[model samples]
Target chain A: MSTQLTTLLAVFLFPGGLFALVLGLSLKGLDRRVAARLQGRIGPPLAQPFFDLVKLGFKRTMVPATASQPVFLGAPLVGVVSMLVAVALVPVSGLYSPDPMLGNLIVLLYLLMVPAIVLMIAGSASTSPYGALGFSREMTLMLAYEAPIVLAVLAVALRTGMGQGGVITFSLTDIIAYQRSHGMFLLDPVMWPALAAFALFFPANLGIIPFDIPEAETEVLEGPLLEYSGPALGLFKVMSALKAVVVLSLGIALFMPLPFDGIWGLVGWLVQLAVLMEIGVTVVRLSMGRMRIDQAFGFFLKWPLLLAIASVVTVTIVA
Target chain B: MTDHTVACSYKIPVGPLHVALEEPMYFRVAVKGETIETVELNAGHVHRGVEYLATKRTLLQNMILTERICSLCSNSHPEALAMAAETIGAVEVPERAQYLRVIAGEVKRVASHLFNVGILAHLVGYEALFMHAMQVREVAQDLKEAVYGNRMDLGAHCLGGTRCDMDDEAITYMRSALDKLEPDVRELEKTYRTNGSILRRTRGIGILSHADAIACGVVGPVARASGIQYDVRTAAPYHVYDRLPVNVPVLDGCDVWSRAMIRLSEAVNSIEILRVCLDQLPEGPINDGGDPYIPPGQAIARTEAPRGELVYYLKTNDNPEPERLKWRVPSYPNWDALTFMLKEAKVADIAIIVNSIDPCISCTER
Candidate 1:
């Protein structure tokens, strides 16, 4: 009963529901502030995303008359829920490790895909033309990016599994513990290709510039999210913010899970998260323009896919 | 390829009120997946019947009314109207007023071109570059506010000559502003020329061929971009443009990038022209002491607006108001060419292609 209760608290309170929401929203707020400063404008306050959530909570959620009310309204809820669980699954080295019964990398990977699927379903269920375009673009982009990410994860799993004198390990705890003992994969030459591939995946998955074609604001009027307003729209924003934390923290855990233990590990992890957010997310998006849907699809197939395959082949040979 | 994936076609509305467009113009776009198969344009959302209203106002009053037709191309209307009035009246504008007239037109061209390019950056989702471009345009905006006391409508033209006189202080301010503006514009031009993000989105994206351009009668930078070496300031040589070193930059790329390059080159050229106008500004009255009487006759006049050739046809009779005032704005014919540009374009390129024409809907519909 206590184990179940602790797991519930972990999911809803500390690292997943409330904790991830605040941290994720804070990261998004920091992103906006940093982007504004880079663009030479006085951006909104650090608490802007929180204010937006509160403001959205007050506004009436308007559903398009033609929309599938159940699917359209329900999609964001699923995304938010998936992200909450995903966040709890991300282990902080020398700090909090998720209960093994909670799940592993495969579960997190499946959870990682939920937001894009939600967006696609939300788009098609809206019954608008732009939404349909959004649906197609989202599906295409996800298909293109998903393969490389899976291979990259496979490479990491094999790398950790092989190092442990086994075939493969899907457990992220084993991966983090292995890194803690064997030193960081971030410095390992064999792992560079996977790291590069994963870095490239950041913007595409986060839906920012360069790969933000599915929700290209100028093109399809933000595509799927066009019809959503009020708390419903706020839920989508919450999903995005939480997703950023899961993805970024996953990056840290996979490659360079910090050596420091206790509260210092928590502090170092967050500082690392902010640094990674600023460099990977902030600087990259500021300096790039969005790619066309076909161009983005082609780009993923050309660069990241090749890199992922290289990483996998290299790990296999080295092992 | 999978049998489960169905090849389907659908219609999407690009605007009546769309985010990409600054004006209310609708494009009924037919799409097979992501590619736009055909585009149907619906205009006149901004049809204010300004041509009819031009006849209701006196020539002097029409100067203000005509300038209000479109904000971006505001100065061109009154400048063209004043040219028509001068043609009918056979008034020789003073050299100083002529130089002043050119200065006003070129300033509007610089700000307008920067705005269009800024929007292009915006449409590509380069928000930083967009904000930077708009920030750069603020120089011209400040210059306008300083000199003409308004940002959009300069009210620069009068029947015989110019209404706005640049004193030594304004001239010095303009010269200093130009000195500051020239390098910033050059830097902007270079970024657009070399930036990978910009090139990937724009290059070979919107192909409006040279032959197609002529067939559509597209004018100004749109024509110049598609390799048609035409400019009203050069071809017709109105005002003091004949005297100024008007470098009409032409490109054969025939794409959105080329259109933007043409505008950038023109923007750089306009700054040089402004400098010359201020230097060679002859000593004379800005305009005739009062509004000169335009004789009862019909006259046609054209000037290069920021968009393209802006033509004004005016006819007067015994009444203080003109009998008729008609115009052919550059955006009018340019709208037809969108069918060709948007032919088989991706749904994403629709906004960028539409914006490349720099379509002034109010000017076109008015």
Candidate 2:
């Protein structure tokens, strides 16, 4: 009974539900403000995204007559639930470690894929032409980015598993422990390629510019979300916010987690996430334009794929 | 093994309310997989009967009416109509007024071109570049407000000459504004020229060849970008342009990148022209301000608008209102060329190609 209560508290209160949602929304708000400053304009208030979400909740969720009602309503809920579970799985260094029974790195990887898959399903179910175009583009981009991400995960798993005298370990606690004692893979030159590949995956997963082809607001009018209104749309926004925290935290745990303990460690972790969001997501997106789906596909196949493979080979030889 | 069937083609309709377009123009793009098979364009969504209204209004009233045709090239319409009316009445425009007209026209060109390029960046998915481009354009907007007393529609031109004239303070302000705008534009030019990602998206994406450009009657930077050296300012110099030397930037790359580069280079050239006009500005009355009279004659006047050559034909018969008023805007010729440029292009390249032509729907539909 006590264990059940702890699990509930961990999932809902501390790191997963409300906590991740707030942190994610705040980071998004900060990104918008900084981007506006870079462009010489005064941006929205930092809490504007929260206001937008609340406003969206009061509006009607009008489902198109052509759309599949069950799938259209269910997609955002599934996405939000998957991300909530994923967030609970990410360890906050010395502050907290997720219960091993709940999940691991592999489970988190599967959970990370839910949002994109949900978008594709929603796009198809919406029955709009833009939604269909978005569905095709989303599928193409997923096929392109998924390979590099898998190889990047493999590189990290091998680096951690070999360090601990095992063939492989899908455990997040083990990976973090190995990095804490032996120093972060971020500092290791052999793991640099995996880090580079992960950097490429970061913006693509978050739907920032350049890799934001799936939901190109200009091209397809927000594509899959065109038909989604009110609470359903707000759910999509919530899912994305939670996913940002999960993905950013996952990247931290895999690569450059600080070795501090207690509250200091958690604060350090948040600082790392903020810096990554600014540099990796905000500044880079502001500087460049979006590439075509084919251009992006070709780019992934050439650069990130090569880097991911090189990282795996170097880790196999070094470890 | 002998099954015979025809592959179905998909029709993707992009907006009367689409995200990529600023004005409402519908496009029924036929595609086989991701490649564009054929494109059918439908315009006239923002059509107002300005020409019909012109028939009812007097010549002076029509000057103001013509300005309302399109805000981007608002001054060009009135200037062209004024020149046509001046030709019929045999009115001599003051030397200083001609210089002032050139200044107003060139300033409008810089702002309009910057806006088009900024939209191109937004469509390309380079949000930072787009914002930076617009920020740079704000300097021109400030210059317009300081000199012409308005940001968008300057309302500078009148029947004989210009309605506004620059004082020493305004000239100094204009000079200083150009000084600040030049280096920022150069830096943006460097970014557009060298950025690898931008190059990947723009270069060779929307090829409008030299022959195709001429065949389609393309004008302005769209034609110049395709290696056609046809600019009305140089081809048939108007106002003070004959006295002021101009160099038109021509590129043979004939794609979206070339079109963008042409606009950037032209904007820089416009600054140079503005500098020369200010330096050679004569000392005299800005306008004739005589009794406005219309003779029984027909005359046509052409001016190099920001987009291209804008031609206005005016006919009068000893009456306050004209008999007929007609105009040939640049967007009219360029709209037909989209079909050729968009052929064999990807769905993602649709917006980029459409923007490359810089089609002004209001100007076209009008």
Candidate 3:
């Protein structure tokens, strides 16, 4: 009973619901501020995203007459809920490990795909032309990026499992433990391909500039999210913010879970998140242009796919 | 057609309120599964009847009214209109005024070209490149504001001369600003030329072949990108362009990248022209300030606006107010060519192709 209570506390409080939400929003805020500064303009306040959320809450949620009322209202909720659980699944090095009963890396992988699926469903349900266009692009992009991500995860799982005298392990705890004792996969030359593949995966998964073809605001009018308004839109924002935490934390666990313990580990993890967000999300998005759905599809199939496959092969032979 | 056949194709209406466009122009796109088959455009959402309004105002008032037609090419309208009025009235603009007009026009071209390219980066999803381009463009913006007291519409051109004159300090400021902008623009040119991602998104995406461009009567960067060597500055030398050595950058790639490259190269040329104008600026009165009356006559004046050739026609009957005022903006010629560019484009390329022409719906509609 106490374990159940602790699990509930973990899901709703630290490292999950509230904490991840705040951290994610703050990171997004920082990204905007830094992007503005780089552009030589005064950006919004650090709390601007949060204020936007509060302001969104006060506005009315207008449903398009043609939209499927249930899916239109329910998509963001499902997305937000999925991300909340996914955040809890991400083990924070020495500071916190997800309850094994909650899930593992495999479950987290499926959970991570929920938001994109939700976006697709929301778009289709909206019945708007742009939303329909977004749905098609989102599906194509998902098909493109998913292969590399699965391969990248498999590469890491194989590396950890092989070192521990097994064929494979999907447990996040085992992956972190292997990295902690044997030094980070980030520093290992053989794991560099997997690391690179993983690095490519997050920006696409997070829908940053280059791979943001599905939600290309200028093209399809933000595609699926065009029809959403008020709290429904805010919920999508929450889902994305929480998603950034889950995906970033998952990357750290897979490649470079820090060796520190307790409070220090948590602080170190936060610092790492900030650095990764800055370099991967902020800087990459700032510099690059968005590729068309076909171009992005071809890109993923070419480079990251090859890299992920190479990483898997290298891990198998090396281990 | 059978019901099954009808089911295969669907029409998607983009914009009357779409995010991709800055102004309201609806495009009814027929698609057969993500590939655009046909595009039908419906414009005039931003029409303010500026041509009709111009006839209501006096020659002086029409100069200001024409400037309001399109903010991006705001100065071009007034400058062209002023030239038309001057030609009809047989007014000889002072040598210094001619140089100053070139300076204003070139500076505006630089800012306008930079803005179009920056927006291209934005449409392509290169936020950093877009921001950097805009930041570089701010240098030109500052120069305009400092010289003409307005960032967008300089309001400097008049029938006989210019309303604003550049002092030595302003000239020095313009030189320094150009100095600061040159390296950054050069770096941007390199990035656009070499960046694989940008190349993939832009190259071969929206091809407006040289033949198609010529047949459609496309102008400015769109024509230049398609290997058309026609530039109003060189072809029909207006004002001090005869004194200046105008090198028009023509590319045969005829794609979005070529369009972008043309704008960048043209920006560099505009900077050089500005330097020459500053050096050759003669000492004289800025304007005649003679009789405000324009005798009964009709005259046409054309200048190379940032987008393309801007033509203004003026007719007067020995009165303060003109009988008729008309303009032929570059975007008008280029709008019809979108059908050719978007013929076989993917749905994703729709916005990029539309923006590639840098279509000014306001100017076109006006």
- Cα lDDT, all candidates: 0.93, 0.89, 0.90
lDDT of 1 by residue, A223-294 (tens): 999899999999999999999999999999989998899999989999999999999999988887899999
Question: Each prediction's Cα RMSD?
Answer: 2.2, 2.1, 1.9
Output DockQ, candidate 2.
Answer: 0.74
With candidate 2 superimposed using the best TM-score fit, by how many Å does residue B77's alpha carbon deviate from the native? 0.6
Output the worst ten-in-a-row residue range by lDDT, candidate 2 chain A.
A1-10
The sequence of per-residue lDDT tens digits that candidate 1 reaches over residues B220-261 is 899999999989998999878888999999999999999999
Order the numbered candidates by TM-score, best leading. Answer: 1, 2, 3
Provide per-model DockQ scores: 0.86, 0.74, 0.77
Query: Residue A21 in candidate 2 has what lDDT?
Result: 92
Segments of candidate 3 deviating more than 4 angstroms: B1-6
Best by DockQ: 1
Ten-residue region with minimum lDDT total, candidate 1 chain A: A1-10
* lDDT value, candidate 3, whole model: 0.90
Q: Give the per-residue lDDT digits (tens) of candidate 2, residues B249-352.
A: 99999999999999999999999999999999999988887645778899999988888888999888877888889999998888788888988998888888
What is the CAPRI rating of model 2's predicted complex? medium
Model 1: TM-score for chain B:
0.98
